[model samples]
Target: MQRETTGLLSPGTHVVEVDGLSQRYHVYGSGPVCLAVPGGPGVIWESLRTPALEEFLTMVYVEPLGTGGAQRLSSHPHGYTRERYARNLLGLLDALSLPRAYLLGHSHGGFVAQYFALRHPDRLSGLVLFGSAPVTGPEHMAEAGARVQEFVERNEGQPELPRVLAGLQAVGGATDDEQITAALRDLLPAYLAHYWAREHEFKAWRETLTCTYISGLDEDLTPDTVDDRDALPSLGVPTLVVVGRYDVICGPRWAQELNDLIPGSRLVVLENSGHLAHVEEPEQFAAAIRDFVTETSV
Candidate 1:
């Protein structure tokens, strides 16, 4: 596997020019394309890469509107709402000429995926969410933020961590890049080791870190925009919600709620894993997704 200076997968960088934006994406394997959405507003398309997914489905990892190789927006304000993200995704699909495809999302990407399913049920074949929540409640939001803060404090002294965290905070709307970096340096190691396994893929991890952090800052998780609990119940599509037993970002309760709301949806909780269970245990994650897609194939 070749590495790039940008720390992204060197093999897959296809640009789809849509609405004057050069949307960068990677296509993996061959079959029904699984359009993957990454977590944060700043996160790039590469965050969704996994060895298991590459073998199972043609995964299309997409960079959000203004990050990675995607074209920058010239507007005064950047749009970070779920609706806007979903619309961009639809545009990407249109550009690719894929009338319908499977949907897979991680972290914040799952939020966009859920909204897309609700808005455009006709364009979906299946839905899969890995370690994601649907419209995080106020209580959950505070707890999540606090946990992230604590994680940052614990790992701030590492050399590489500061840069990664600083990029993350910038994406998260932190004006003070130095402060965010200092804070994030303390948190990155635990975050990667426990949640997303950033250590294993160190070469390409910075892109993932910077993108996710910035995206988190840009996100607008309001009640009006993302009401997946109500929307998911009527989705009328095959849905899979995979949660990690040790995931603090999106705890098991979040998955349980989604499972209960979405009719016939399956929820699988992976033990000994955190937020990025797919990366931590790729084989099992891939097998589960393959089985679900196979069963739902038309």
Candidate 2:
């Protein structure tokens, strides 16, 4: 894979100042722009490298307010509401001078993407959600907590694993910068290999995680927080819901429900993959997205 920077904007990370926050985004490639929202409130833009995706769409990966290179609004620990994130995204789009573009979101980013679609449907050409659930119910959050507990238990006996687990827990409720960075670096390897194949490009992808926070379970969006499922049908834009069959985090069932709710949305479940289907099955994932974008663009 050839890696070259497209100087679409200023050389380094550019901050888009919004109300009480500044969102950071990386602009790369040149074609139809696709804005990608990273998973965590703390995850960075370059967590996943979509080599296949860059072939078609000019990808813009955004670090949410207070995540990655973005500036934090307050030192006080607070969970972000979906509306706040959606508005931040709108502000980012406006700063970039993008009137209408495809929106692609992963994990928690999916929630932000959905909120954007609901609040500003006029600005979106399409919506793509990967390993995401429309409404994370209480049961789902409870299950997620259980999974974290189980992961903690399984790795407890190992010397280094305990530290990593503790760090991960810290990430869930951390407000301090040092704690978040430590949590991110500790969990980097497993996360990288779990998603990408062992390749040179994979190393580049792994490097991006150094300053990024992978999603936080404490601030997850559950069913009770979501207002309406009925609004999805009227979104009008073409939608794609992709999930991993082995995704314990979001799972295939969540994608099924989203597919059912969104009119003209296509659902694809990759059998061997987990939550990070795009990384686990890059080629297949890319082909599915390419075909969908092509079909819908017509």
Candidate closest to the true structure, highest lDDT: 2
Error of 1 at 37 (Å): 0.7
* Per-candidate local distance difference test: 0.68, 0.69
Residues 50-116, model 1: lDDT tens digits: 8687786877888877665566656312446677678888977777666788999888788888888
Backbone clash pairs for candidate 2 read 136-222, 136-223
lDDT string, candidate 2, 1-298, tens digits: 1112233343345665677575667766556778888775566667655878888887788777666556754532344656767888887677667778899998888888888897798888889988788676686677556655544554455565655567566666655666676676665433322332344544555444644432332244222265347778777778999887656567776789899999889999887666666777889988888888788677
lDDT of 2 at 14: 62
lDDT of 2: 0.69
Q: What's each prediction's TM-score?
A: 0.77, 0.77
Cα distance off (Å), candidate 1, residue 193: 6.5
